[model samples]
Target: MGSLRTCSRSACERAAVATLTFVYSDSTAVLGPLATYAEPHCYDLCTSHAERLTVPRGWEVVRLALPTTPQEPHPDDLVALVNAVREAATDRNQDTGPGVRGSKGTLEPPAGAGAGGARRGHLRILREQ
Candidate 1:
């Protein structure tokens, strides 16, 4: 059976309940629901770690508005995320050396893409219009 995701914190085996992502450009940490798919750079944290999470003195954590209870993950969002991961993995395995020609690579997403490059359903911190 597929097991629940474990916390990203080293040496811990507890199932993750939340996800944490860092925006290094702005020195901000964004904590929200468990990601649809775990991106390599994002952190999957267990309840205890998430509750006690901290950052360096100059950094900030922005906790998005989460529902009072755990809810089901959206099917469409999960599918999109899984597809993105598969595409990325496939590209990695293929040789992209200069000797290979006429390969149309996946285009980079335009600005406003969600964190960790998932296409949709993310909690974004937008500036006032």
Candidate 2:
């Protein structure tokens, strides 16, 4: 059996055997092995960093599972399905209007537009004379 491995995050020094691996643009790290282990969904977490975890932005801890018999969609089939979905989404987002100019247009208003042409309230509101 493989020995427990420590978290790769510089701030953390926790031991983990089956860890939910996080693969970012530049680095890969583990979350935890957990006390009560399970296949694919161990709920163990690092108490120290629990409060700091912000979903979608900060560290995303996942449960590690043991290798099991492969089931469901085949690899090639899954790849094809993903490609199809991506292509569909891209097509939906593409500009069907005039030309390249329409392609540059955004779905929402530009940054500075305010509600009812009112100045942004967050900025300092000068009292009218």
Candidate 3:
């Protein structure tokens, strides 16, 4: 049997056969050898952390460039990647304020004023000028 190891990350204390391997570029940990595993490679982690395992802060995750086989990527992978990119784009947009192009126009209030107040509905059309 292979020797057991613990996660090198300071906050973790999981024991497993394989410790996460990191590659260094210049003075930084640039990537990992086991980053793209379809399942949790390490053991003893809670469900949440195990599900979201990846290269830590300051490490640039290097994706595997292997040729794709007949099998397609898992749906979970597509969802995770898309969600990550969306979150990153949102963060960048918030910081930069909608990029080179100005506002895509403004959001105006609904056309008709409600009797007492605005009645919340499923779909409300904005009155854009």
Tens digit per residue, CA lDDT, model 2, 1-38? 22243443466666433334446753534554344434
Predictions in order: lDDT = 0.74, 0.44, 0.43
* Candidate 1 wrongly placed segments (more than 4 Å): 1-3, 66-129
Top candidate on TM-score is 1
Error of 2 at 90 (Å): 5.1
Tens digits of per-residue lDDT for model 3, 1-129: 221444445686653322233445532322223223424533332223434557657666433332222233578987998679657766766666754464322233445655433443553433323
Models, CA RMSD each = 15.4, 18.6, 17.2
Clashes of each: 0, 1, 0
Q: Against the true structure, what is each candidate's TM-score?
A: 0.51, 0.21, 0.24
lDDT of 1 by residue, 1-129 (tens): 222798999999987778999999999999998887889999988778998999999999999764455555578977999689768746754757333675434444547755555343363333333
Model 3 regions more than 4 Å off: 1-72, 99-129
Q: Name the regions of candidate 2 deviating beyond 4 angstroms.
A: 1-6, 9-17, 20-65, 68-95, 98-129
Better of 1 and 3 by TM-score: 1
Ranked by TM-score, the better of candidates 1 and 2 is 1
TM-score of 3: 0.24
